[model samples]
Target chain A: MKDGPDIARIASLVGDPARANMLTALMTGAALTASELALEGGVTLPTASSHLAKLIEGGLLTVAAQGRHRYYGLAGPQVASMLEAIMGVAAGVGPKRARPGPREPAMREARVCYDHLAGEHAVKMMDTFLARDILVRDGQEIRLGPNSHSYFTAVGIDVEKLGPSRRPVCRDCLDWSVRRSHLAGQLGAAILDKILTEKWARREKDSRVITFSPKGRQAFERAFLEV
Target chain B: MKDGPDIARIASLVGDPARANMLTALMTGAALTASELALEGGVTLPTASSHLAKLIEGGLLTVAAQGRHRYYGLAGPQVASMLEAIMGVAAGVGPKRARPGPREPAMREARVCYDHLAGEHAVKMMDTFLARDILVRDGQEIRLGPNSHSYFTAVGIDVEKLGPSRRPVCRDCLDWSVRRSHLAGQLGAAILDKILTEKWARREKDSRVITFSPKGRQAFERAFLEV
Candidate 1:
């Protein structure tokens, strides 16, 4: 038998409908209060607290106490990615839910997937990067190429100031909607941040949808296009 | 909130300790009898059957009746990949078990990941393919280049015979041990099959380990290396 970390423990933590909802909500990359999570999970605050405790203990989530208020978020990007992968498989193989979200198409066009861009627009950006040789892929690994710095700089992103970090600079995260790869890593986050700062897009309140303005869409396309 | 498939339903099926063990055991890509899974899960035969039924119902597994006996295995490659991704996250963030298996080193060197090869040797083969331009990586997608046909044909993989399938010719599966990409998909399965058929390596009984003999190791290296 293969010896590995106990996946059951983690899966069980995510197995509950209430907990799954909370985790999915947290994938928006926001630190939310218990009340917010409770609403998200369709559970009471006390019930949400208990579930949050288990997730925190299981390392699936982390809590920060600010004075009397406690805010919870995903433990890290790995947790987010795992949830995304779970959603990917669930969407593919599992039974359909009774009520589908009303914003399915908008969500699929652009959304926040744990602090990084995902969905169609993100996939397109990734494709453009590869087509322009700005990002080079070697097997499973992705690396920023020589042209990347100039390109990112041209788009008003401080490529040099990203600084050194323990996290990988570039990574490929599988997009659930498109069934393709999108950039996910420090660079991915930086790119999303740049877009938001430039007013190219804005995340919808209480939702994962990332809506872009007509002008912003044209600007984004022109900026990230292959030279 | 995102309205998608009910992830909790499928996850809870995998959440039970006994069921998790059985699923992990099935990760070897071998279809085993209920009695075998019972032993793997350290549960009673009836309990194992119940859990297997739930997994099958949840679409995480599938069962086939062979004569008077029933054999259980993962539903498909997607299910296997999902399990692998779960394991990857579990290994990274979850609490460590008290008793780590003694074969950890060997398991990490070369072991079966579902159906295809994984671990060190598999990562090396993927690297060689990229270095030789036999497999081209376009961002998150991998494509078999012009050089691929001749190279695979030289190695006795009837490239033309692989035929058209819904599955892609190449895929990059993230290796848990190496934290890198390894080959997967139809072509990956074919390479592993070729290695086994040519007596280059043999899978250890009741385990995922694929041990290559000294001579076989040399032959594998020479065969995969660029001219």
Candidate 2:
């Protein structure tokens, strides 16, 4: 209470079950309305409205009112980064749940990060690119190195048309389940699309996990030198 | 269920009350042991152990066993990112909490972020520097621009002695509370330290909130130009 507000404010805002549930729903980065969140959190609409108010007051979220429907989203990328940092500690510190049976191994392997791919394999893919000089770190953003131009060009990425001003590349989107960086941004979306179209990876119904077909595995190995 | 396992996987992982509480504690970015977390979550050690096992097996966490104590943390920065995304959604979509009353207000204004200064004021300070051509963004880092050396020198920051390779001159640390980037790195730390030393700000124990005194406010206004 003595430390003005800052992290404590953000922390307390995230500490509650209803609020946490609402935030978890927003993880996909899409804007949602109040009633939808109320159902997601299993609370009444009025109660959800109060919670939304607190979050906005706390500066953890922003509200966009379009006529009768008001859409809310995270205030900015910094909020995402902070939540990620906390999730890291939570995962590290919490007790693990019990998994039964032959364990759906695919969940542990690679998964979708929002709309992109992430996991041990994803990290390996990133590493392969780095080793091949396909991508280089440019401050917080990753840039497609000059050497990797051919790979993208071969894959039909049309990097030349993107021009020099716009950053036409992939960003390291952090994967919660896989605990590694996955390709994000325009390139990431394109890659995800390509995989789905080629039937290399299929999205599992009701979950973020992606199951790779034998053909997909082979393709991934061939395309990015999958580790 | 049609979106594959991504939504369900993330939601179920965070659905449990005890696990959620444990995650709330870890949001501070500090690692804790299973027993410590057990106590915090109001669960038995064995129950905490089981949860920890599930989280680890689920690939949401990694463990570093030192002697008899096992230290756990989010698998990596990717996991952190995922968690943040989820939290953003929750904060955006959830119900609100009642106010706990103001115990301190100054601390909420500005404070140190890891190693640098953060909050609204810190962000404004960065803007000031950029406007004056005293700082330049270099991809993932910030460097002194053409006029920065002389500008900082006039402001009492020894640029020549600091050296170019010693540390990052400037970069933005994502501020969770403000959901914006704040000044980070050695320069940030220096400014924060100077503020505290000159009685411009004071720290609130057990939290990172910093309060600015009347004199401190005036000094900061004079030094940083209206931040």
Candidate 3:
């Protein structure tokens, strides 16, 4: 007897290419202006504006007035997670559009998944963490190991000082390309922040790819890839 | 540099109300005919046929020849999983369309999610299973607990004889209504099959609601809820 949630409304909002691009741009965990998003969506400013308004109305995004300009971001992590889940299904339902673009290789290697890193390196890191007992499975949830606080401190993230957040501290997100688990949630976001702040990788312009510098790649390998 | 997966295409397909209705109807894990699907979608046969063509072309569904008619079903488990994920996001994004219908109460009480049971009863059963250690967490996957075979057998499901399939033996699907884990995968499908076959619950026609007879309800509680 239940008529279920109205998935079509949200689905159609994300279904539009221009809006999808705008939303994907925000998944970098960075706020962007309408013009920037318009450029990313490959649409005229007016069209982009209309799309943005719809997105806000759809509850998929939020707008903030920083000054004369307005900054837009995904309303919350749920939007990003929803987008990623759709991507996973799309990857499986490959046809002409599912073809990998020129940047696909780089994206497959390393990319930003919402607030966290996702790709080959990210999946590998998840596997290593599970293997080393740095992350433990707690029923339906994943938890950080009891003695893994030192590991986080060494990587410049203070677990206790993550402040307050409604989201879980440790979460496992499905990586589209790898079809495996990737680190997500509060700690996941912090780790991505650390990587960028440390100059280990730089997020590409208007793209999800995160290119690690040669030295950064080596350092990342040494830290997470090895014991 | 990566132009990520084209989620917009699939989203748009499901975004259409008629198309979405048709797809959701198929989520019962039953193979429905074109005419039946047309009725569910609330569209004319011609319109439904065109829509079905697009869905088939889009790779969201599959068709099989049976006698003189064709039966449609979700392409695989991934489609069902993706639909549930979307439902989860839509549930959180309650603006106006998220309002519960009269049947919402019934759906919330007991319903089918794709191939398995969902709603209050389903979530309760999952909690009890985990609490009693009938289900164990194996990293990101859920596994059956050792010595729990008797419990499943008593419920009339033989895990070992579930037949070979690409899908896992046990999977945890997110329950949109409860925002909790519910059993899915081969074992889950088997349990649902048992439920219907044993007359524990009768699925409501043209809806997701599964109404349990009074006698059946008591038996279910004693079997899964009682120690």
Candidate 4:
């Protein structure tokens, strides 16, 4: 990747209209092929390839070559952060008169991010644990507090078992939209997966929104003390 | 805000290359005029005017008239967030490559977020306070913990007198770079202002970067245990 004095290079890469469209498609966090992205961006295959090359060269994207096809994604968290920071400002104005319609209320209320729980419900659940002294904040790290181990057991989740997997049992995720902390680690992700597997929530098609089922509504209320 | 089926209208408004450039310039957080932003975006005055009008019409920008010139800025936090979200995807592949250099280090260290604090230093500062029981996070709200009020008093800020102003004494700002909480709100802004006023830190001209003076560094270390 060009490390310095590459502003012109980076700018020109994004200055293209076709490339910008493809990038937007990937923003949803789904992996797609060059052909798929080309169609999404309304560009020819060769043009998309060129754009993908430039993105990869800039360290803004990473490409995984699998057999006859190649998949491209943002390079890393830093790339994502850069885009997020820019969006935070860009979202403020310009063609903003047409506000995106109100998100599905259910998903906005409670949902998942990647594998973990997020949105308002997740924040509230974390709040309940902290208020009850089940979790403690320690220097950008979250630790189970007091009788957290027993508490998890009482709640029917085995916190200890989560450690064996690469998935984290507990992790802190910053909710970009709400600008608050939400649970992400292995434990948190497991809990969300559990909810889905048990048919508590269903992911909205073509959207990140998660719709809670009737049973999920009752179960979540009981588990997390929803009023 | 239309809050209607106008994704195409909104996209077209943002879709133009030159307009996107002007918006990106404002994305850095400074309010700029037609002439200044035109130069930044590499467009002519008439072109800039048209772009600005579209942006303003699209509700992505708001203008504050100052005599003959109009200064445009992002309307609010939501606008900023939307831009960020868009660019989150748009920046995937720029045409140019930036050579990694010394300048990158300073940017990664500390920067400004509109009127708030961001970056690693701010994130760590907030984390330390939370870990040491100096601050507490309650859902989306941030508050001083058990002895935090006394601690603030002992440190020399007159929280009681400042009450008439009704400004929040402390707040948790989510650092865009670190993806963690940082101190913000009235107190965070005040502290930054004080540091600059005392010549402990200085802003890089035309940039969000902050440079700490030797004396200011010592003061920060003594006061906040900042490294």
For B1-227, candidate 3 gives per-residue lDDT tens digits of 12678888888998998888888776656677899889878899999999999999988999998789998888976677678767867777656554567688899998887678888998898788888888887665788997469888877678889868646778876676776778877877887787889898999987779999998889888877773
RMSD per prediction, one decimal? 5.1, 10.1, 4.2, 7.1
**B-chain TM-scores per prediction:** 0.67, 0.63, 0.67, 0.74
lDDT of 3 at B197: 90
Over 4 Å off in model 4, which ranges? A1-55, A63-74, A80-103, A110-216, A223-227, B1-30, B54-60, B74-113, B116-183, B199-227
Clashing pairs in 3: none
Each model's DockQ score: 0.50, 0.07, 0.51, 0.19
Tens-digit lDDT string for candidate 4 (B17-118): 676667656655679999987886688899889889877887778899999989998765445444433443333343332343455567557766555555
State, as a TM-score between 0 and 1, how close model 2 is to the true structure. 0.50
Which candidate has the highest TM-score of all?
3
What order do candidates take by TM-score, descending? 3, 1, 4, 2
Residue lDDT tens for model 3, A1-227: 12678888889998998887787778787889999999989999999999999998888888999879999999887778778777877887856654568888898899998789999999998888888887887654789896578777776678988858788888877777887778888888888888899999999986788999999999888778775
DockQ of 3: 0.51
Ranking by lDDT: 1, 3, 2, 4
How do the residues B1-227 of candidate 1 rate in per-residue lDDT, one tens digit apiece? 44555778777877888998898877655677899999888899999888888888788888889799988978876676677777877887777444556667788888877568888989888889988889998876789976898888888888677769645677877776787788877788898897888898999888878899898888888887543
